[model samples]
Target: MQYSQKVLDHFMHPHNVGKLENPDAEATEGSPACGDQVSIFMKVDENTHKIQDVKFLSYGCASNIATASIITDMAKGKTIEEAKKITWKEAAEELDGLPPVKMHCSVLAVDTLRKAIKDYEIKHGLAEEDKFSTDKIIEELKKVIYPNVGEDIVSLKMVKYVGFKDGTAIVDVEIPKFDKYRDNVAEEIREHLEKFKEIKDIKITM
Candidate 1:
């Protein structure tokens, strides 16, 4: 697929491409099932709760690289609260707009960024212990409707597993072979998970 010039530029020369040793907080997000993963490392000011530095590592397509790079550029030096408000749509716009199918790449980047911040908050005792919950995520996933099945994915026996840690949820789903509805299902699951502010990342596998 032909990517925009901005996308190509960011992908070719991704910014802040390494991890910090003993960072204040860190997080990883993506579909282990799809093998598209990103890990974010951040350094924060303990007193001010501001992001002092940020970086990322990507293991996916050009969209992944570009989105990750742009997010870091937009996040560095921002206060924790400000960074949390950075949306995937803003990341896509910063990239000059990714292709429709590649929109998920932007989501992955934003999710990782927020999760990293939450990781910092949780570890520093700024967030409550029950801030992140695996059961709540499963309940949220149960609300997702599988487009082709017209039933909740949980009811259709599609959810294989659900795991949660440090504000990221890993969900494994099984869809029959050659099922054209796979993308739609993944997108719907993402939309549902996005509603939960504490949920910083979501990975739906099929």
Candidate 2:
């Protein structure tokens, strides 16, 4: 497929390439089996709480690697709060535009950034209220039944990410590139979580 010019540039000469030293927060993410993985390291100036340096290591397709490079570049010099606002859309825009099928590369970058921030927050003992519904309900459910495993609808690691807006809830799930079985896992979880009127939107992502 012929990628957009910007995509080609990023793929060919990614920015902010390398790893940071003694970073305040670091996170490794991606599906190793799928051959897409990224590790992000960031250093924050203690007094300012601004990211002073950032780096990444990635093993993936061109878009995935390029997105990681872009995210690290964007995070540098920005406050943690500012960095959190950098969305997948911004990453895609930076790359001009990615093919629809490769769009997940951008989402992966965004999720990795979140995971890194969460790691930093955890390390600092910053226990603020979760922005979204992360009630341990999912944990309890895991014990009772896994999402899509054990030849049962209840045993799989089906849920990927969940977001909320007001009372609307959005859930994202990974569709197995090989199996059709997990396709409806998100819907089932949505149905279960929708029991409360507080949930206004339940999104199934695959």
Runs in model 2 with CA error above 4 Å?
A: 128-206
User: Per-residue lDDT tens digits of candidate 1, residues 1-206?
Assistant: 46899999999999999989999999988665554789999999999888999989999999989999999999998999999999877988998887766776777788889889889988988875445577778766665656553356777788999987787888999997688878777876876687678878987778
Taken over the whole model, the C-alpha lDDT of each candidate is 0.83, 0.67
Which 10 successive residues of model 1 have the least lDDT summed?
142-151
- RMSD each, Å: 7.7, 10.2
For candidate 2, list the clashing residue pairs, or say none: 146-154, 146-155, 147-156, 148-156, 149-155, 149-156
**Backbone clashes, each candidate:** 0, 6
RMSD value for candidate 2:
10.2
Candidate 2 lDDT over 107-163, as tens digits, reads 667667877887887788764535334453353223221223322222344556656
- Which candidate has the highest TM-score of all? 1
True-vs-predicted CA distance for residue 116, candidate 2, Å:
1.0
Q: State how far residue 87 of model 2 sits from its true place (Å).
A: 0.9
Off by over 4 Å in 1: 129-179, 183-206
